[model samples]
Target chain A: MDMGKGVGLVETKYITVASHPHELTLESGQHFGPVEVAYETYGELNQRGDNCIIVPHALTGEAHVAGRHTPEDRVAGWWDELIGPGRALDTNKYFVVAANVIGGCCGTTGPKSTNPETGKPYGADFPLITIRDMVQVQYLLLKNLGIRRIKAVIGGSMGGMQVLEWALMYPEMVEAIVPIAASGRLAAQCIAFNAVQREAITGDSDFKGGHYYPGPGPIRGMGLARQIATITYKSDESWASKFGRTFSSIRPQDYYSLDNRFEVEHYLDYQGEKLVQRFDANTYLYLTKAMDLHDLGRGRGEYREVFSRFRGKVLSIGVSSDFLYPKYYQEEIHHFFKQAGADSHYWELISPYGHDAFLIEFKKMSLKIAQFMQTLS
Target chain B: MDMGKGVGLVETKYITVASHPHELTLESGQHFGPVEVAYETYGELNQRGDNCIIVPHALTGEAHVAGRHTPEDRVAGWWDELIGPGRALDTNKYFVVAANVIGGCCGTTGPKSTNPETGKPYGADFPLITIRDMVQVQYLLLKNLGIRRIKAVIGGSMGGMQVLEWALMYPEMVEAIVPIAASGRLAAQCIAFNAVQREAITGDSDFKGGHYYPGPGPIRGMGLARQIATITYKSDESWASKFGRTFSSIRPQDYYSLDNRFEVEHYLDYQGEKLVQRFDANTYLYLTKAMDLHDLGRGRGEYREVFSRFRGKVLSIGVSSDFLYPKYYQEEIHHFFKQAGADSHYWELISPYGHDAFLIEFKKMSLKIAQFMQTLS
Candidate 1:
């Protein structure tokens, strides 16, 4: 019942797939076996088993999607605000499911996962996986759960990438898809930022080429990576409004000291430290690289051809201030869906929170998702 | 004269200031002595010595403002296109001087410079300096050159910060000021990027608390910092146009390989390696810290009050794509100059190069600078 720090919802469960001869061959031609997926479910599956809704999570997100198991639990699931009985996800009406993707650290098969072959932690030996691979793993999990067609699959950012993949790979399985703050292909700037973060992790002497686990690990590198990522996650307007040029109250009034003088610096340092405490450095590397390799059209012929196969209604949402996955990306997806003559709707969330708006401005997102859900009915 | 890689024009000169017993007191109340400044001059000082134009270099810029001493010199001075004969700066008509800043590595007294007291490098012991301190050093150099007043002072980015400082700290001495692609105060996002870069350098175990000079210093960390910074110096539009999601031609066609996939990654890696080769990591820390402390109205009452003291024609130019020092920042400077009722003009350079447009896209900047010079006359 304690659930521990970063442990997902109290009801979170695990399913192991691709064990032994059923090894999952990745897009890179490498295979991983006995992959474990941590997930949580809410509400009822219903008689028809068609009311299930899968929710994929963004980078650093866990399997927990709603509710706290223990009374002393300080944090609820990430989507606790929107996945309750009367919320947008409306657990009373829909059976909601959220799963930690492969390459994630939170009880999911990742760099920290043990390799059955070597009887050692995979570490750097974890085969590179893609958004498609993650979606395939989720599909296998859903199949093993005895679910065929899902009512909807909703996600944002990297989760959105998974949503896109789900619609493309298993078009007949999902009735609706909501991909928010995501792109068919990540922009060059986004890739650049991710590349730098990977460099920060690898450059650390503590990283030891991603084999630094079972020890203190590359905390400094991971912390620095988190700091860089936190900057891209928030908009300039958001930072200006929240911190501005205000100096930290605790710091001395030394004019040109190297110590954190600005409140923003202090905030970033805190964010970095927070991530280092909870996140694994090797997992960070693997997952970010997976995000960077997310190109839907890769190995696929034309994007229009790919979208044309999807029978589900598409609801694409973007944040106006989101630079990481800009509004244009969502628009592009909408355009492709429209080109295919598929039922599609595009909505832009105007917020100063940047790429993080989907998580922060829940009211607007909740309204949109609820409206989209009605169309699915 | 082979001036060496990254060295300024052959005509560059040096002058030692703040020698022993006359140590320069920095904004942080720390003192440093035997400070040497490297500078280069174009054209002659007129009989009245009033044809001088002191140009302050940016964060990584050197004293090279124009021309090459030898025809075989592969790289000309940074602003060579704008500061030559009949050019924007018009070396034929006006004397132009560009000096390396106090905390700069290029022939200036910086962290790499030896401490007279310790007889070793200053390294981390180098006193924290501000933009005002840099301007003061240039002021001393000008005084040593027997120049009472200059025709104008011109700079962009960090150089622009120095231009504002020079006008405010010595109003009567500068006749005109041209600050391009700069801000009165660094925005929170800028500070955040700088903080990450500093963390990267300091986090390097090889950094050795900033005393990693005269040996293999924090090259990897410095490289990573430069990689992060290179992204900021460019616009998303530019990166898309130049590199896009194009894969590196040399890399294998493996779908999910960890190697540099995109051309942008290769470009960033090249930029990082280039900086690590020539630059001192400790100097990078000092100079970036100086930039972060740049506040025109730090000790001064208000922004308007600070601008009112500058009796000079102000021409503020901004790159339309510059995110680091956005056009909005330049507009703010122009606003304050106009509020003070000082002669001011604002121009925006339409370019995809972003913050680096001042260095690239020379033709447009050249014409603007030429027209502004005519107005000054």
Candidate 2:
């Protein structure tokens, strides 16, 4: 049952999906290229090559989908428990590949990558990319690796957006998909949340127009932005259950000062501080913008037209307590797919973790995914 | 149907709830006094001086409850829709009074007031006050005005917190209470939201340790804080319906720039900018802290013990779409008051305005409040 021992140690590999000067024309009419995709693969692809499954990571996630980087690594990949041999994806029976999306700040080419034109990090110079653009990059990676037909593509949050995008763009190549806690088009409130987060980052005096490459680079603003994201990621019920009026410490004086912390405040600060240490603020800005602009039917006609192109089987998983991407979006995904006469189903996972339920409520999510994967045949 | 003629022009008046040298010991074990309460009245006190309805204003609200400050004033008070002659409170039939809470920046004695000890603005030096302390000051105001009792105490959001506090503190003096979108004790998530808003104000470089008087006083940070508040004040469905995918303007370049914004972001910036112009950053810090510290049973007893002392009739009004203070809190308020054997009824207003429903969906809220008021007579 141990995922680490089950999958063993894994190594991340990188490939330039689009070599320099060979631009990948994006959905935004911008030519972005020399794109790199960092990914990890588990299990053999099999002789027929029909057993491949793609795992896409969410915002702020890297290409590592399961297993430890090294035997000594303390943390496995984000979806370690839900993947691996004998698990939902069942690495023993299927070949799985998880790649970092374009415009990501991992081992992939993103705002942090050097611009061929200037020899400096792209930063805000990175062109705005959409969910379809990210899916295109994934397609390039798969094609380069000679993995033709996908058994299924699965992910949550931004990853889920990618999953749906893949099915829409390549219904013939991908057979099944599971999109969890994603939106067809982001709600106005969600866009507003993203807007404020970007505002905090840019509002910081240290932001330096996204050119502060060597300096600390808007750490405080990014921290505040992360804090806001953390608040929305979880359910109000979960926060109440976890932190509920508790002071940060037993110190009496901490209760009287504005600077003093609540237990929840301390948790948020830790989350903020942690992300700021590893993330580039410009990437945060770009990725959030991508999310804000994530409309499935944009430039692609109406909902009926968008759903008509996809004939893949779908399992849309929604989290009942999700605040950011409510369960309704997934239900909408299923409803539209069904209306288009495509094979589609939806399961709203009842949880207290809000939009983060897919990540935190691993056991429940694993069960649902495993049941659905079993039916994929 | 003309609200202007219904209530007519009204003037705000101020009274010192506590004179110099007469310190009111606070919940924090700090002595804070010489407190002034700013208020406005409509109609007249009856022969028995008991036909008075106290309208406790919410956070960032003022003593101006209804009517215009001047006949030519562009905007009426926050609750002008529900407080005119033929409205819910019905000024033609009942005397209605609204007071600014302490720690507020309105006309009340708050962080903006001059501290007698230092002869400067209190700023963050203002003692950490609680909902109970605000209620106590209101009690003093009624006593000084020679009004013996309140026919009912009504409010929404923070005002609702005050409504609950009034019934708990002086049960014999307040005949009835209507707490809309309030909590028995604030949810931990609500406290976390307050914490972040305070952090933004205090984290600002120009805050100068909360003594940024004579300067712009953390306008950027306060603006960001207000923007965050505005998002929470609205429902997701409302935002989708109101500003979905709309650009700030018709500028073609706005679609490509991170600095350029969506229609929702533009609206939020306007809200933030407007608030920063009128509000003091230090008061924002102090008032939110007071709210975070609001606990019905704090320094008193268990909720059952506290509610046992209040015999006032209760009408707890919940808002179905309120993000900040969800309807569940109001329902919880009703549950506790009823369990204590107090005359309590719960009503959840279904509106898409979220927490702002009480302030915006006035016709629906009016029907409920007016019916409740009718029962009181």
Candidate 3:
């Protein structure tokens, strides 16, 4: 098992994958060739290989989900709090694995990843992927690791989408699933936010239709997109308290001109510029499109019939202030499970951090999740 | 008496210089040239010419404040609500006059106006203007119209800024003032919002640095800027009740595929595109920047000292829900007036419409305004 990035003091064997040839046959009867999957593992697989936990990441998250295993990279793992020694998932007892989604900027075979055939970045040449495709790739990764069943499929946000897919696609292969701060499908507001972000990128002259890498890549446009995203990620109440009527420099140098002043404006600029450095514009576009297409049980027939595919226990968590994947979405999930006759539990966690509550309020949330998982025994 | 746009149908007299020379030396010590001003007359000026009431316009508002008497190009006025008839400013009793400012696109010499020197659109060649420069041009326009002492100065938003400037610049010529939904000085947050909007326009590749006319002129970027402005125009509670998680698009067009689904996405796109048709991107930038530089007290010393210049009766009205120019801004005016020993009345009107209440809640606000003006008797 491999320890994750950002966490220190852990010992584990890391599962490695060779550059194996990958082929994906899509719903359109089309086939994609020369695919590669990049993933990292933590903790250890038990004798039955049934103690494994899987985490799917959000739009920008990489495969590094738990500890700071890479000494050179100093950033903390995305889920450092929930998966560690004696923590929520308790890496001491259960194995954990997280993969960079197939179409991501990370090491996964995404837009940023090189096309083996062309010897250049896939860019827009990569076909648009659905959530089902991502889940299928993760399943292949698990098979490569010799794991037949997952003790629990767990994730939040986009990660949570994968958790739902795992439960439905291979019911007996997953005993329990925890989908946190996620929705069964992308609502109108979510799609709207993503559209604005995409416009910010596509409208930029530097974008070049997602092929402007090696040169400048619409950083300002991408920043504006991030600015829009930043607004939805947090609550309005947060902005009121943080900015209000604060003033700023009017023309940069004038001290007393009373010009170009407002704290919210500065905050937005900072948010836009910061995302430009850490994220790629094309990746943002593709991942958001993936999120917009995510619907757990849409194809199997009615929502009830689709949810009935999963016969295992399920735990769904939502944050009170998460307007993105709101509590109402979680309520819908609970209703679907109940109607499907699955033993499902739904919990709401109160936090003022908005959609980011899953990460910030992880202490209380982690305890609840740990307790729920222990009940699976 | 002149008929303001929406005011009572009165036959007003006006003359267009058609070739009026504009341009003034800015406080920045730069010479700006080739200017124009559009004006209309209400009741004839008395022999002493002291009954004149100078009415300034707000953001995006033209100086057609009353009805038009000319049969050639008849256009209704913008302020038909508060002028003419037995309304707040009875035209029969007072000599009312209004003029389009120097930097406005409405009939005045602005960026869109042909530069007499070059006979081409001024575009960005127009010198950057200060609020003081705008007031000075209005002063020049009034001088050319053979006006001396004025009875009063009134306006809201940008117009409010002019009213405050008139009081400070030519206190003795003003007898009374009404400033609605205005601020003492532009705050930091206000400036920041304006800055971001300007950035959005100039950052667009199609903007051509304000020269993209006869073409689209970065309409998409302008639309995005307006969307941002629209968000600030209304209160948080209003948006919450109006939008919530409701689908933004009533008809799903499948514009981008299943990945780009949502009503809010479509709503914002429609709104952003709609604004580009009605608004000029450069004009928007210039006007917002003017508002950013509007501070009657800036560099002129203390705010109280600036208020001391207004030796007249003052009435300041603010809307309770107006976050743009909050009620506290009204209180600031009231405080400054009290310190200056000027007779002043301040009223806060409770309304849910926010900054827009000044325009919508006329019934309640007009009563307070009329009563205050009567007290000046």
| lDDT-better candidate, 2 vs 3 | 2
Model 1, position A165: C-alpha lDDT score: 92
lDDT of 3 by residue, A1-377 (tens): 23222236433333323343345674334466556666778788888888888888887787878776666656567888888767788888788888888777766767776777788877777777777777877887898888887989888888888888888888989999988878887665566567767877887889897788777699999988877677666654455556645555556445323234466767888988987887778888878887777776555776557888887888888888675676877877877887888888899888777787777787787778888878885
Weakest 10 consecutive residues, lDDT, candidate 2 chain B?
B1-10
DockQ of each: 0.68, 0.71, 0.16
**Model number with the top DockQ:** 2
User: Each model: TM-score of chain B?
Assistant: 0.95, 0.96, 0.86
Off by over 4 Å in 1: A1-10, A249-253, B1-10, B249-253
Each candidate's lDDT (Cα)? 0.84, 0.85, 0.73
TM-score of chain B of 3: 0.86
lDDT of 1 by residue, A1-377 (tens): 11112323467798887776348888777766788899988887888778999999999998887888776788888877778676788777888889998988998899888777777788897878889889988988888887878999999999999999988888888899999999987778988999999998888888898787688888888888999999988887888899888887564656466664688888988998999888888888888888888888887887557788786799999999887787888999998987888798899999999998888887788787887898886
Q: Write one digit per residue (lDDT tens) for candidate 2, span B1-377.
A: 33323577889999988886447877667777888889998888887889889999887888888888787999888888888777888877788888888888888888878888898988777777788888888888888877888999999888888998888888888889999887877777888777777767777789888888877899989999999888889888899899988777467756766566778888998999999989888778777877787778876877657777787789999888887887788888888888888899999899988988888987788788888999885
| Candidate 1 pairs with clashing backbones | none
Cα misplacement distance, residue A151 of candidate 2 (Å)? 1.0
Models ranked on DockQ = 2, 1, 3
What does DockQ come to for candidate 3?
A: 0.16
The segments of candidate 2 whose C-alpha lies over 4 angstroms from its true place after superposition are A1-5, B1-5
